[model samples]
Target: MSNINVDEVEEQMEEDEFEEELHETIRFLLVEFRGSLYTFTKHIANMNCERVHRPLNRRPITSRGYNYIHKILKEDPTNFREIYRMYPDVFLKLNNILREKTHLQDTRYICIEEMLAVFLLVVGHNTRYCLIRKTFERSRYNTSQNFNKVLKALNSIAADMMVKPGSAVPEKIRESTRFYPYFKDCIGAIDGTHIPATVFGRDTNSYRNRHGKISQNVLAACNFDLEFIYVLSGWEGSAHDSNVLTDALSRNNGLKVTQGYFFNATSLFNFFLFFRIIYSIHYCGVRYHLQDFTGQGRHPEDAKELFNLRHTSLRNVTERLFGIFKSRFKLFKTAPPFKYTTQTEIVLACAGLHNFLRKECRSDEFPVETEIEVPPSSSEQVYKDDNFGELFDTQEQQRTNTNAWRDAIANQMWSDYDHIVNKS
Candidate 1:
C-alpha cells in the first residue's frame, strides 16, 4: 500500500514539470513574433517617407536654351547683336580679352562664352535670373554664379578697356574750327546723370532725387568720341552733382585732371575752382540750351549766347554718350534687385564695355547723326558751398584768370561767328 502511494506522488510531480516547460516555450515564441512584426512595420513606414532628389536640369546637352545659343552663334550670327547687344566678333574678342586677363576660367560644364552670355543677358536686357536659368538651361545656382564670375572678370580688365585721355587733342575738337582753339585745352566733358536704383529701409529717402524717383547720382567723364574715361557712381540720388564731384576728386582712384587742361560742364558746376573746368554762363534770361539756337534765325545774338551755344554743342557729347549707354544696357533704366555695391560695379563694367565696343565697332547700331537734345536744367542755382569757397580761396587768382580766359574765348568765338553769319 505504501509503494503504490509513492508512485502516484512521483507521477503528479512529472506532469506539473511538463506543463511549466510548455508554457515557457509558448511565451518565447510570442515575444519573437512581436519583435519581427514591429521591425517589418517600421521598415514600411520608412519606405513611405523617403524623398527622391530629381534633377532640375537633365540632359543639358539637348536643352533648348543651349541649342538656341549655339544656333545664334553659328547660323544666325547677325541676330547675335540684337540678343547680346554686340556683334559676334566683338563678343568673341571681348571674351578672349577677359579670359586672357581675368581670373575667370572655364568649368567642366560651362565654357567662357556661356558664362559671358549669361552676364550680358542680365546686364543687356535686365533679364531676371530665373529667366536666364531657363534660357541657359542651367540651375539657379549655376546661372547666378556664372553671372557674378563674368562681372568680376569684366571689372578686372576695366583699366585697359576704359582708357584715359592722352595729352594730344581729340580729333573731333581739333578738326572743328568752332571748337579747336576754344576747347583745345579741354580733355573731356563731365556730367552727372541719374540711374534708376532699388534700395530698402531708411536709405530709400536718401536715394530719392528731386524728380521724385529713386536713383543714383552718377558722375561720368566722357571724351567727344562718346567713350567714358572716368565713371564715379554709388552716390545717393539726393546728393548734388557738385557733392558727387567732390567725392570723385577726393578718391584715390578717382577722375584725374591734368594741369592746364579743363573739362566742359554745365552751369550747375560753375562755382568749382582749382580745376580748369569751363562751365556755361548762368546769366538770367540768356539762352543756354542747344535747342534755343536751332532755327533758321536763331543764331547767337551776343557773346554769352555764342559761348553757350558752343558749350552746349561740346557738352552735348556727354549727354549723347549717356543716351547710347542707357540704350545699349537697359539695366540703367530699371535697377535690378541686386546689392547696392553690385549695382555700382555694374555701372563701371558697363562703362568699360561701352569703351570696348567703341574701339571694336565704330559703326554699330548707334546712329551717328541722331540728334539727342539736351534736357533743360530744372534749377539755375549754381552749386555753391561756403566750405568749398574757403577750401579753394587760395586759388582765387587762378579762378580769375580762368574767368578772363573764358571771356576772351567767348568774344573771339562771337566775333568769328558774327563774321561768318554776315559773310553768308
Candidate 2:
C-alpha cells in the first residue's frame, strides 16, 4: 500500500510538471510574437483544446441558451413576442432552418434558437451587442458572432422564400370592380425609399440625401397581398429611382417582369429602353392624377383622374410594406453599427425574415403595426412633393405616348364605372 501511494505521488508530480511546462511554452510563444496574429491564434487554439479536455467549471451558457431562452419561450410567451418580434412556431421554423443549414455544428454553447433570437433582437430593435450579451450572459463577441451566423442563414433562404406567388394579381385582385381589367396586366407595385446608413470616405457624400441624412436608396416590389416579391437595396441615397430601376432591370439576376406583366413604379418610360415596364405617374405633368390620388386620397373627378386614383390606392401597398418593414425591423430606421457591407446584408436579411414570417402566419390580421403614408418620389424633398424633371426626364415624345396609353386605360375605366353605376 505504501509503495502504491509513493508511485501515485510521483506520477502526480510529473503530471503537474508537464502542465507547468505547457503553460510556460504558451507564455513564451505569446511574448516572442506579441504582435503576430497567427501565433496568437494558434495559442488560443491550443488553449481551447485544453478547455475541451478540462472539466467545465464554468456555468452553463444561460442567456442565449436553454436556461433563460427556453424558460422565456415556455413560461412567458408575450415577452418572447416582444423580443423576437415573432411567435413560437415562426421562431421554431427559423431555428430548424438554422440548425439544418449549420448541420448542428455550432458548438459555441449558443443554440440555433438563441442565435436567431440574437439576430432578430439586434435588427428588430436595433439593440447593441452589449445589451444582448448581458441578456444572454454571453460575451459581446459571442453575441455578434451568432447574430451574423443566423443572419447569413436567413439570407441564404431569401432566394427561396422571397419569390413570385405564381400569379401576381390573383383572382381577388383581378375581380375587384374598381381595379379589374384596368390593371389586369399589373402584377405589383414598385418604389424606392431611404434607410439611414453609415459609410465613410468618398462614399459619405454619395449616400448623403437632401434630407442631410446618409441613407441607402432601396427599391422594393411587392404584390397586392403585401408580400415582397423582389427587393434591390444598397444604392447610394443620391441615386435617382429611374437610375436604380434601370440598373435593377439591366442586371441579369435583377428583377424580371414577364413580357406582358408589369409592376407600377414612378419613372420615365422609354418605349425602346423599357419594353416590359410602364411608369405609374406620367413622365411629364401626368403625375397630377397620381398626386391627388395620394395627397387628399379622394376619388378623382375625371376618368383620367379616377384611373390614377385607383392606381395610387392599389400601389400604396408597397409604401405600407415599407412602413411595416421599418416598424418591425427598427434597425432599418437607424444605421445599425455594422460595416456598410454588413449593413446592406442586414437589409436583405430583414426582408427575408419578413417574407418568412408572412408565409408562416396562420391569421389574416397583420401583427406588425404600420401607419403608412405616401413617401416622396426620388424627387420629393423633406417628404414634400417636388418635380424632378431636371433630375429625371421631360421628353415630349415619351410623354405623348404615355398620355395616349393612359387615355385608353382611362376611357376603359370610365366605361366600366358608368356601367356599374348605371346598372346599380
Candidate 3:
C-alpha cells in the first residue's frame, strides 16, 4: 500500500474534504438568506395590518397616561394639598355629588373619578372636550355626555348653594364701621357684568353688548363676605341691570326685598327708580361731587361725598366677587360658545358653585391659583331702555321721598363719623 501512491492518496483525500466544506458553506448561506426573506415578509405584513385595523376612540389609558394621572393626583398625602386648593373635597365629595345625581353608570372602562376629572379639566383648565378625550382615551361622545351631565347636576344644586343675605346679614352691616347706619339695612351690592356668549339668529343683536361682542348682562348681588346672595342671568347682553332687576322682582315671590333695607348701587342701574319700584328698598349710590373741594379731593367736603366714598368702598365686595368667579372658571374667562339659554345656566351654575365653595371652604377668598393665570374676559351687552321704566312711579313724589331718605342716612353718617385734624 505504501508503495501504491500513498502521497497521491493523501492529496485526493484533501481535495474531497475541501469539496465537502464548500458544500456545507453554500447550504449555510442558503438557509440564512431564506430566514432573512421570511423576516422581511413578516414586517411588511405587520405594517399592512396596522393600516387596516385602526385604533378606536374608546380605549384604555396607555401606561404613560396612567403614570401622568398618578403624578398629578398622588396616592399619598404629599401632593394632595395642591389638589385641595382647586376645591376642597375635589376627589371625595365631588364624586359623591355626581354619583348621587348622575344616572351614568360606571363601566369596565369609565369610572366616576375619570368622569369628574374630565369635568374639572374643563372648568379648572377650560380644556376643550377633544383634548380631554385624547388624554382620558374616551370617545368624544363620552366626554360630552359626562360634561353636560355634570353641568346639569351643578345647576340643579345652584339654588341650594346660594347664600341668602336675608339671614342675619343686616346685623353685620349695622355693626360695621365701614357701613354703619348708612348701609345698616343694606343687604348687598347689585351690579351687572357682561359675560361673552354666542348665539345664532335674528335675536343675536340682543345678545351683543356695548363692547360689540355677544354676552349676557348678568346681575348679581353680593354681601360683605363677598358671597353672592342672588343672581339674575340670561337677559340679553343689551338688557339693562335695572330691567333685569325688575324681571327678577316681578316674578311670583321674586327677589324679595326687605322693607327699609338698602343696596349700594352704581351707574349701571337707575338708582332713583329702583328704590321706587322696590318701594321699601332704599337706594344709596355713589354721588358725583364736582367739587375737588378741599383741593386735595382726598377728604369729602360734605356728607354726600363721604357717603359716596363709603358706598364705593363697601360696594367693592361685588367687584371682588366677580374677580373670584371669573378667575376660578375658564369657561367664564373666555367667551363661552353656547346657546343663550345655556349661557344663562352656566352663569347661574358658576355663581352657585362660587357660593358653595365659599361656604364649604370658608377661606377669606379664592386663592389666585398659578395654574390659571389671567384668563380672557368676554364682553356682551346691548344698550336699550330698561323694561321696567313704566312699572314703577315715574312721578317725582317717590323720587323726592327716596332723596330725603338717602340724605337722612348721609347726615347720620356724617354726624357719627369722628372728625379730627392732625395739627402739629
Candidate 4:
C-alpha cells in the first residue's frame, strides 16, 4: 500500500511540471506577437506622417504660363500686342523704365515683364485675377501682390508722363486755314465726361447722373493732339461741369491756364463769372451742335451758324480724345469694384499711359470705334484771360468787351468764309 501511494504522488508532480512549462511557452508567444504588431504599427505611422508633410506639386517643372509668354514673345510676336495691349518694344521699354525708375524689382521666380503683363491684362482687358493667375502660372497671393506693385510703379512715373501743356499753339491749329488766325489764342479744349463708378450707401445718390447711370464726373483738358494735358477725376456724376471746373481751379495744383490763352469748351460753362475768361456763341434757338450739320447740303446759313460750325469743329478735339481714351482702355467702360480713391488713381494712371503711348507709338491701333455726337445746348466756348489785364474796369465791362470781341471775330470769319464759298 505504501509503494502505490508514493507512485501516485510522483505522477501528480510530473503533471504539475508539464502544466507550468506550457504556461511559460504561451506567455513567450504572446510577448513576441505583441512586439511584431507594435513594429508594424510604427512603420505605418511613419509613412502617414511623411505623406501629411509632403510638399504639393501643382505647377509643372516647365510651366505653361512661362511657355506661353516665351512663345508669344519669340515665335508669335505680333500677338503680344493683342495679349498685352502694347508692342514688344514699347512693353520692354516700359518695363525698363519701371525697373530703373520705380520701386518694382524682379523676384527670383518672376520677372518684370511678367509683372507688367499682369498689370496690363488687368487694366486693359479688365481681366480677373483668377485668369491672370492661371495665365501667369502663379499663386493667387503672388499674382495680386505683383499687380499692386506694378500699379505703384506706374503711378511713380505719372508726373513725368502727364506734363502741362506748352504755351505755343498746337500744329493742328497753326496749319489749318480754318483755325490758324481765328483760334490763334486757343490753347486746347476742355470737356466733362462720365465714367462708370461703383458707390455705396449715401454716395450712390450723389453718383447718379442725368442719364440715370451711376458714374463719376471727370473733367479733362486735352491738346488738339488727342493727348491729355490735365485730368480731374472723382467728382460725383451729379456734379455740374462748371462746379468741377471751379474745383479744379480752386486746387493748388489744378489746371493751369496761361495768361491771354483760353480753352474751348461747351455751353455748359457759359456762366456770367466765366464770360470774360471763356467765349461761347449765342446758341439759344440756334443750330450749333455738330450733328446738326452732318448730312448732305447742311451748310451754315449765316454768321452765327458759320461761327458755330468753326467752334464745334475745334472743340471736337476734346470729344475725339475722350473717344480714343475710352476705346483704348476698356477699364473705363465699366466700373470696377474698387475704392473710390483707387478708381481716381486709375484714371490718372491711364491718362499718363495714354500720353506715353501717344509719344512713343504714334500709330498704335485702337480696337474699338467711337463716335461722339455733340448734344444740343452743348456749344463749344473758350476761359482765364490774364493777357487782357486792366483792359476793363469791372466784371460786367469785361463781359461786354468779350462779347464785342467775339462778334468782330465771327464777322471776319463770315466774310472770309462767304468769299471762299462764292469763289468755289
lDDT of 1 by residue, 1-424 (tens): 9999999999999999999999999999999999999987886676432222235645233244545666677756667888898888888888888888888988755778888999898888889988988776777878889989998988888867777888999898899999878889888899998899989898899999877789998999888888988998899988888888878777898888877787888666766675554444333468988778888999878998888888878888887898888888888878778999999999989899989988887888454334333444666254657776575777788768777888898899888888988899
Poorest lDDT segment (10 consecutive residues) of candidate 3: 372-381
What is the TM-score ranking, best to worst? 1, 4, 2, 3
Cα RMSDs of all predictions? 10.1, 11.3, 16.1, 12.4
Clashes of each: 0, 1, 6, 4
> Candidate 2: which pairs clash?
63-136
Candidate closest to the true structure, highest lDDT? 1
lDDT measured at residue 75 in model 1 versus the true structure, 0 to 100 = 56
Considering only N, C-alpha and C atoms within 3 Å, which residue pairs clash in candidate 4?
260-387, 265-381, 277-383, 278-382
Q: Which regions of candidate 2 are displaced past 4 Å?
A: 1-64, 101-104, 268-275, 279-299, 362-403, 419-424
TM-score between model 1 and native: 0.80
**Cα lDDT listed for each candidate:** 0.80, 0.71, 0.65, 0.78
Better of 1 and 2 by TM-score: 1
RMSD of 4: 12.4
Query: Candidate 4, which ten residues in sequence have the lowest lDDT sum?
Result: 376-385
- Indicate whether candidate 2 or candidate 4 has the larger lDDT: 4
Better-scoring candidate (TM-score), 1 or 3:
1
Candidate No. with top TM-score: 1
